[model samples]
Target chain A: MQIEAISKANSPEIACVVLCCRIFIKTASAEELEQFVQAHEMDWDEVYKYAAFHRVRPILYKVLDNCKIPAPVLGRFRNYCRALSVFAFERQVESARIQQVLGQQGIVVRMYKGLDFTKLVYGGDIGMREFTDMDMMIDSRQLPELAKVMTAEGYECSQIEYLRRFPEHYVANKKDICFYKRSPMGKLFGFEFHHRPGNFLMDQSIGFRELLGQDYLHHSAPFSQEQYYRLMLLNHGASDYFPNLRSLVDMALLSQKGIGSVPEQLRRVERLSQELSMRLLDGPAAATPADNVVMRCATRITKLQLTVTLRSVWERRYMHIRFSASFSDTFRMAMKFLHYLMLPNELDINGVQLFSFKLYYLAKMVRCVNFPGRFKKVFSRV
Target chain B: MTQHDIVHRNEKQFMISNLGNEIVLMDIQQGHYINVNPVGSVIWNKLAVPIMVKDLIHSLVEEYGVSTAQCEDDTLKFLQKLQQHHMLNVQ
Candidate 1:
């Protein structure tokens, strides 16, 4: 009853929309805010509420409403908004440039969460998410050449010597660049070029290499673009969106617009979600020995078997979800329960403590029974 | 706050730091202040309440090891500047 009361009060979907609006308006520049004013009609009261909560959201809302607004002074009040707008505009510009660079290098550099993330996820009615850097992953072998091209184009490569001396553990996962500026203002608007996503193990598992470039169901669906775009959306959402309701909203939007079975897409998304949760919660060293068990279990679970899992993940109140230690923790628990509800087994693996491999094997057996031909083989080799 | 009674601590004020390499003043509340460095930020937390001239000078000396005499003078000057800008008061 308590859970029901809380759930009825705060809708995750509404929160997602409001958060998107907050991010969008908080980041728009005078020029951009002016564009917003001309381009769309907004509920000023709601925009004001968002601005109150998130510092930059209102400025962005204003900018979108009136692009002609003079740039606010770089004081404390306007700093956040200014920073956000600068970050948004820079990401868009850099993503375009990175796309061109990748094109020249014969790389099919798929853009995930660039302009579309802001436009579609934020409901196009408000400003979109603002990020300080643009993330674009390329073929690992292309790292050297990509670095060279970036350097030639005025972006400086991250100095290994400094990293070694400083030894920041966070930097190890993502390869990046400062791209020093030439002008005074340009100096404020420096850029970051990211080669990797987050953690090393994560990079290895979901990296471009791990990505089953092999086509999925989205291939048959009719769209202006080909299979790669759909995969990009799935990968991005699977990698980043699960913990936050906002991301799920984006996924929902994509599911609505794109011609496909929403439930089926969600089912596949559920699988990816499980895998992501396992990877994030189980550290690399801890997960190494248990990889087989986890993989085996993951392969076994069916969508229908995960009814309780979905109920738990989608059913919770905001306070419970928001205050949960981290996003990964919440998803992992929900997924593990889903795994058990399907087919139970005692799975074994060194780092895979959450679900026993035996349980996974049982789920796999159920899947094998349903889709005899497609169940294929165990992934113990990898 | 009298200019003579004022004292400034130059060790590092989170309230005024760098923005793209240029130092800029930040809004100050009761306790929190953030100094934006080139790389990112250095946030100073849990500032002593009712910050006094002598206390700030002592803090600067203990934190940065500046001479007490110079610390007091500098702190005074900085406090005056903050007072002018309505950031701090003698209440």
Candidate 2:
């Protein structure tokens, strides 16, 4: 029903676009959309929003047809379009500072996610979503040294504990490491260090070492401007651990440009889809006794939907509970919990798996209920 | 488990932060100080609006496996903290 009736529609391309729109609509308003379109040098029309909102399936299909966007790069295009507004204000300043840093350090750091993804994945002439933070990923090994250098240059590390305790663990085992600094403007900006080439979905073996060892693509010093641009989007999109459609769109846009290995990258991510799809359809065994009912009922939604739905549910379930200083801060924590829950599990893992997931979920629910503030006394003593 | 009597008179919004594990009152003006301790932050983030103190205590009891008596005591203490901080305004 969501599919458009275009005769030559690229199934993957169209689906990704539709997905991006859904996410974009959730956080953005009609006025914002217009402003974003104008900032991007695109024609801003009220009708476009209606088409995007009402019959997004067909409208996206038509846009793809007219643009002749490649099936693999649809994700990247959406990100580009969404970032237009913010880019106008921050692009030059941010990129110049990053470029200056890279040049001075003799290191090549690529921009990813927002506008960079648009340039790499989409048509290189798109807008992007209005997200507050900047995500950049550097070589995993270079992170510690880079962090030190940056600290010397006035970038104070926000997560001192993570830097102290998790650098080796993340470099040697886990995914990217998240580090941030409060900008002079008080905005929180993030940087991620990546040892691996692919994200969580891809086999960890495809790390920077392996990819460089195999000499997959041209790996040169002082990378070309195009390479720098594409690398940023690739890194940004990959680090989005959640099945956020906007992230997918960012990557898809890159694929269209024939930049990076979009097809191979997406194929690897398909594993996430296949695993979740199977779990939802076949009714994978419950991890906990209480979770059985929840899982069975949850199967009604697709496995991909599970992550986003659970995330939204968790947010609504715990909106009033103060986890930190602000609702925004608390929501961020809830999203983290949701991300943790999205971890893939082995099929034969038994009820222990179900139990843990449900346990966490229920625990979160319990926190929402405010049970006579029983835990407060214990908390006070500590 | 100690029952912390949480009163939400004139309550508007609430939030829980992860850094210090504190429950913050979002409704209060410039000097909003509905704060909690680490353990309190864990429970504070879970309090949905329109939540009852009893149901909250019951859920905590099941999840943490705490005794009913502890739940009652804890709840009361937490509520007192909220009142002290001017987080909860009695009708």
Candidate 3:
């Protein structure tokens, strides 16, 4: 893609980060990278900020290590890379231990995106990807037994605590629960147990059994190449709103592994994500569709800010509704948004007594009464 | 184990990564990390297969152009530390 095209709405610094990450994936050449870096007269601070925010710092460090950069700035990047490598190593060790324990209990849990992708896509060099937590797919029915095992292993599930107080809410809404434990070294480790492969917005929840097959209990490979790519598209693209450059890089790398064509059953948001990724990596000519409508939608989504902000949140929700697969899905997303605005979960009233729960509800209702005005502001910004 | 004995990595107890110049080893059972420097990383890589301590010292002396006495002393100290941490299988 043209450098100007890459920076259309994004700051030049963000474009640099994206190009650097692309270079690491071999979509762009080192000479082009050198020219881009030197031509921008870049702000090193903004480059670092966006790179870290997008969780592409490791890739950025790899590409820029050979480039002409200030000594101190390069040192900072190296330090982050080293720290992430150690952190990833620790998580791997923890993942192996948990998998072994769960295996002995006759409950198989297959790892997904985080460390699994590090090994699959990055050649087992965890430093190439920075992931904060581990994601594991498990049988939803086994949760009660899994909870027991997790507790025995010193993991605390706050979702279970929430479920105890409001079982109906949890059962109706949540497909995953996070278990956390602090290491002796004071580092916090998180493991998210997913019962469903994709989000609630998808047409149906593809269960672990359906996606990985019943025979997967004995098989080592968690997902086939095509299934893994589809999962990435749905979970990261459709579910997450394709929020980061790292996701794009992941799609790019996975596509090169001979995953064949994108599935025809993809949701609107997922299609848009795929088109945008292809366009960014291979330029506009590489876009498969001659359809102006799809190209327009992809371009619009690309122009949205990649960072988290109130405006971006509103934009993402708009995209979610606009790209929803069905009217019912749109309605569900709308209802969930209102629910989030009006309801106070356990964490919101953690220290409050039982009687104060009603007071808390009343206060929330009063605050939500003014939500229309806030909604108007968000809409106007869009 | 004496200096003449063979030593190898206790591979089952640790997960290792050679990051850039340093070798990082995570002790799976203890959740402790040991960062090995470039020289120590060379020794760790050499220990992938078993090697006697005396031979290890001799190889380092040849490669690094260090005196025999100094190489032997440093190599023995490093090996003893690994043994203390149960990261080495000495025979």
Candidate 4:
């Protein structure tokens, strides 16, 4: 009659890992707790890594508190949670301070994504989730003034490094770019100044320009709660090959009454895979993926699974109808997508610009050969 | 409505979280925070369950070895501040 034990045995290591984490912070008896640990074989470290990586260490703390886990691990997790909570509070205070200044200047700032999503999903407990950056949407014309304001506050555009390296990056991408400032404590805070720009990977961005004249500036967030959750479900798998587990967890929690989160993620991935398969028929277009291996894997699977049949006919109609764009637009996006891979961006040496196509391709080659460096830099930064 | 009325009232309107040494009381509807110091932190922990002002003061005085008069005075002041911040309500 042990549901936990049954679930653990029936599910895979990954599913059980997510399942235990999904239920760990919630009410659980000793038997449930035993199965939670027993289900995790060579997965404790992996779960911890994902928890920390996704900034859900605070969530992990609550789960581990009821266990007979080692003291050192528990203590470190507690400390991490405490530090994260403090940092989140400071950032919230900072946001309030900035909001005041911007308000006085009559600049309507629409906060969204990162922390806004956290507040809606986790109820403003900063420790409950981790947000390394903030997302604020302003009117497109307000960019210069925001740049001035951030610069006055000793903050530089976070995209400055990327833009410097790839001069066309500004034109190639959407959104107003992000501003950066290092706190006195050495934490880098990024404020993404998004205006939507109608250039998301799926090209289904909310009408940024249309909402400009409205008073959504005073809105709680960029999108309503329903829209926010839906966007997370949609965007998580659109151009990205893999769905983020934590985002999936958030979606699940947000829509618990609906489809279960992990199953929802698998469905989204399946949907997006179809979209990518359509793009493969057209060109090597869409958002950037890491390497040729990913590109080949996706293309090979879709090619075999696809035929000039009823299902393929429906998929072709579905994808094209979903995205309204011309062939030229697709061609431009294809080049831009490749350029994103080739250019010296966050994934490359900072301040290094390779403007020419040849130089860009060379950098791309080097990046593929030195893939471990990418993971190293990310871990180091975190 | 007044400091006397808030003295023993329980918190029901606001949501709260304990971050180890500190506690954060939030008014989700208004998006405001009532932050407190370590001494005020103890008061927050005590307020988790209902207790009279006199009882809270007595416990604090015993735990900190302070005089009853001083404990009562400080507790009243903290309670008054909580009332001003709209964190307290009628039990």
Candidate 5:
């Protein structure tokens, strides 16, 4: 019932959108479902668009059967659920295959966000969580083995030059080298092989690799349940300034179920997420009257075409990335930013051949030259 | 379509998943899905490559204990259903 007052049609706030999602993750009573639909049926399309943007419609679809979902909404929801189920299946198969191969070969690795994480967060249902990419954490020493095994499994190195071309960015990010395998339908999912944790901005040490290493790993070091929640919270709070509500819901769902006792650090992180943004219960309390318009404008990469403006950019940046800053963190980020600009290399172009050093260098040069213009635009907004 | 007409899968239209005892085929183009038994699963896999209907019948008769006439009838009906759903194209 309370969820009905959340996201309205045409313009939906981020807090309301997340609150609407909580109805499904936590499972609503029939009365609550009826009230929600009765209240928001007219403007449900806006909620649908919001859910689609966040890539969380499939999880919500499971609850449709218990409620008297409208025909049009049900059709759209079912179609999305089916499509997601197929992609999730593909991701699951590919991820499992990779893990199987690597494990057989005795390459100790940790699978981060993929089918396993979906199962951990949303139970063992195949399509409960949308999986666009599979993230794994392996030691830097295992890079050659990762490449070979991925190649054997028909995965092509998406960015082979980034490691050598921009050592500073590589060191700063301490992240994955994505490898891709295209499905029969031409859909591509990347196998992001992470080496370490922490970013230039966040000094948090809750990485799955570091958390469940050696004996606790069962020789594979798959992300333990609690560890995944911890990482999600850490990432949402610190490393990833623009934390998606879907991810927060994932943490909440796990926390609600009381799976894997929450550590003191994670409990602190959860409370921080509540304080930083609108929490699970806070509805539209923190949301502004124009937040929906601002959100619609901020979602530039999606179907919406909001005109870019200085204030809109500032608002979008403010909404998406709200980071806690210390002098040292800013100093380190500034250094990393400058170093990346000096020698840019993290470039992955669609249909472009990775082996072409000339083309790669050309793209890198273009980014480096235009970096100043982008940097100026950021400050211009504020 | 003639019985001798070549029959293979219009892979662009269909996505087949073998679920042990059941064969699930999704007509992605039409947004419809159908399931068949183990017998249909074998026939579907055999239809991966272009083959004459008679040849498919012969293979089915040899592998399955069903009579030639029954195999032909059932297979024809199954193929026709596939065609009706746009899961297959009969030339």
Candidate 6:
């Protein structure tokens, strides 16, 4: 997919943000960036909020520090960047420690997305990228051992109780288990252990282990560059519905390294995400007239899917089915989602193990019936 | 310590990054970090190699155009804080 230039129709704040990110990714020249910044009457508050919302504050700070921003706004950006730098550094240290310990226990794990990509794309500058959790891929068989090691390291597993009570059900339904630990500074760090890559609805015919190959266990570079980019696009973009601009920046940077063609199943979503990024961040000349009409319709659908106020379980399930690879995949995903909704998990029952578990399902059905009235009350206030 | 003492960054004890004009120092043992302002960044960069307090003050006074007396006072206080955090090594 090709990334076009930022659209001129964007608000001043959005334009500045897009331009700043473009400069960071080296797609736009610094002189062009300076000219755009100087010509516009920018709303610094909006720029800050938009950057934060998109999880691109670090990139914004990095690119705009050289531009002629107001001193107070620059200071705010710098302060945030510095704080994130500290957090990223701490996450790196903690991750390395965890990896070392896990390695000693004969479990092989691979880091993804966060500091790993920071090293790969940002030249090891942690502050320029932000990630919510430390994502690592491990062999499914090693999960029990991994959990023990995590608990020993003062981490609390989110699914420990569930897994302990109904291991079979938990494994069948969940792709990853998250463990969290709080730092002395009171910041929480989440470490997600993925037994399989991609979302629950993603087709798992080719497992991550197979894609990474036999030497994955001990190879210094477990995934080839192509495989890494593909997994990122699928897991980060399509799976999570392209939650923020950071994912697009990641794709843009990876593409610069010359990624092969995206998988056939992922092409549409990848194109749409790339188009959205280009439409918002870059100019619009790359798309032909025919392509723009299709993109316009797709972009609206994506925006509606991403709209927080309108988001619901039904909307998410629709997205899952919409993005499914095949007719069979769609049916499978719909069935899985129905299973997820009808069945009450440990959280729903407050971890109480019942003899039948059917009683909880009945309660769930009653709650579903009352949901519309409850939603009406909440929606009225909004 | 007097102006004759030599000081340098405790590189072995902290993971440091130069973030634009500011500096971030993460204490490896403590898992906490300190943000050094632009002036502190200048001082930290200069301390890359061992230098005497008098020379450090001379460089700061020249670069920032501050009074020698004021630079010495502020630099000493900053260096003392680093020492308190164990982020500096004095000789």
- Best DockQ among the predictions, by candidate number: 6
Second chain alone, TM-score for each candidate: 0.51, 0.61, 0.94, 0.76, 0.83, 0.95
Q: Output the better candidate (4/6) by lDDT.
A: 6
- Output the better candidate (2/5) by DockQ: 5
* TM-score of decoy 5: 0.61
lDDT accuracy of residue A39 in candidate 5: 54
Error of model 2, residue A130, in angstroms: 5.4
lDDT of 4 at A24: 40
Tens-place lDDT per residue, model 2, A208-307, is 4333333322244433344432343334322323233333333333332444432354332333322322232221232223223223322322333322
DockQ of each: 0.02, 0.01, 0.32, 0.15, 0.04, 0.39
Candidate 4 lDDT, A1-382, residue by residue in tens: 1334433444333333344445542423445555656655534555466555444566666666666667776678777766676566656656767767777777777676666677767765656776677777776656656666777878876555554444444434545677778876688777777655344334543344332335655555345555554455444433333223354456455553343223332343434443442232121223434343334534433333222112353343233223323467556666655554454445443423544634645655666666667545633543
Model 4: fraction of the reference interface contacts it also forms: 0.07
- lDDT for each of the candidates? 0.39, 0.41, 0.72, 0.55, 0.57, 0.73
Q: Candidate 6 has what TM-score?
A: 0.76
Return the TM-score for each candidate structure: 0.35, 0.39, 0.76, 0.59, 0.61, 0.76
TM-score of chain A of 5: 0.71
Candidate order (lDDT)? 6, 3, 5, 4, 2, 1
TM-score of candidate 5 chain B vs. the reference = 0.83
CAPRI tier for the interface of model 1: incorrect
Candidate 1 residue A152 Cα shift, in angstroms, is 3.9
The parts of candidate 6 lying over 4 Å away from their true place are: A1-10, A104-107, A215-217, A222-225, A261-264, A283-298, A301-317, A324-333, A349-351, A356-382, B1-14, B30-91
Please state the error at residue A335 of candidate 5 in Å.
4.1
Candidate 1 C-alpha error for residue A30, in Å: 26
What TM-score does model 4 achieve against the real structure?
Answer: 0.59
DockQ of model 2 vs. true complex: 0.01
Model 2 chain A poorest ten-residue lDDT run = A344-353
